[model samples]
Target: MPSILLISDIHGNFPALQAICTQHPPEQFAHICNTGDCTVYAPYPNQTLDWLRTYQAISIRGNTDDKIIRLLKGQTFKKPGKKEKRIMYTSTAESLTSENSAYLLHLKKKQVLKLGSYSLGLFHGSPADHEEFLFDNTPEKRFQEIASTCKYDIIVTGHSHTPYHKIISGIHFINPGSVGRMFDGNPAASYAVLTIDEQARQKIQVQHFRCHYNTEEVVNELSRMKLPEIYGIMFKQGKKLN
Candidate 1:
């Protein structure tokens, strides 16, 4: 059996990602897959990107990444209307260096990977759209339809920042949640591990895990950077502090 790590929505919190990586080193896994939103919302955009590059993790472009790319190209995909979103976008965009921006711009939007005997579809959101969200509470019928339409035996996604594993239409769907900014009332980082049992009939096992990091460090950095105070509040409370 071989194990693969599934991570997503890093949101520029390097400490969180580092903590998760420390617990499950890259050498222990056959492959590492990131579902996107690799940068933004916290400090350390450059460091987070550097970490991902060092690990050679398979990554897909997330909506946040797309926004950064659009900014770099002097374009706008969607205007940030809300105050918090505007601050988040602006702060993250300004923090990224030209080199980091280029790396993000080149990230693929989707990936179909062959992991051992399993064919996996990786995306930031649903297969049909990158901005769409597929959460744990999504309707099974709808998930089944999406599963049937895709060519993969398993679909791995992120963006809702919630972790789940479900079988729909005989296809497995997993979301490893957010590695940086978690919104489920827990400040701990979230991720998943997929184990492929070559000798077993079932063939796959999904395990979700959370790692604790120094949230105060991120919060203090956010404050030091003069990003909106709400960002720090959200990091501390694990929800919108408004």
Candidate 2:
């Protein structure tokens, strides 16, 4: 049997990331894959990127990650509607260390991994669009279309911040959910353990897990960092603070 740990949307909340790492050490799995959104809206993007680089996790560039990179390259999100998010991206981009920024700069937008007989496709969102979200309620026809086009047995994604596993058109679609942010009214860190049994007819199994962390601690830290109050409210309520 071989296992891979799937994680995503670690929006710079080091504490929540720490909780997941503590519970499911990366070494325990054959490989660790991060779908994306490794930075933004949290206080420790540098620490988060450092951890991923240290573990050599297979990572893809998420939408927010792209935003940070662009911001570093003198791009600005000056649109009136993006004021809060612009602050987040600018601050996060400025906080990155040179080493970590370089690390983030080299990440691919998508990756395909071959684990023995199984092939896995990793993306921050849907295969076609890095920011497109595929949820449980996404039309079956859409998934069928993706299955027809995507060339992997298992497709892993992030960005929705919601954990789910669905098999459509004989393809396994898995989202490990958000390690740093949860939008489902639960303030715990979320991740998934995917196991492949070589000998079993049903070869793939995914276990979604949530580890409890101190949400208020992150909330307080956000205050110290002078980020928007909505982020703290989102952490406290475990949902979008719109």
Candidate lDDT scores, in order, read: 0.88, 0.89
What residue runs in model 1 are displaced by over 4 Å at the alpha carbon? Answer: none
Q: What TM-score does candidate 2 get on C-alpha atoms?
A: 0.96
Question: Ten residues in a row with the worst lDDT in model 1?
Answer: 76-85
Per-residue alpha-carbon lDDT of candidate 1 for residues 104-190, written as tens digits (9 for 90 to 100):
888998999987767999999989888888899988988988977899988999999989999888899999999998898999999
lDDT of 1: 0.88
Measured on C-alpha atoms, candidate 2 has an lDDT of 0.89
Residue-wise lDDT of candidate 2 within 86-190, one digit each (tens)? 788888888889998888888899999998887999999898888899887888898999999988999999999989999999999999999998999998999
Displacement of residue 118 (Cα, Å) in model 2 is 1.5
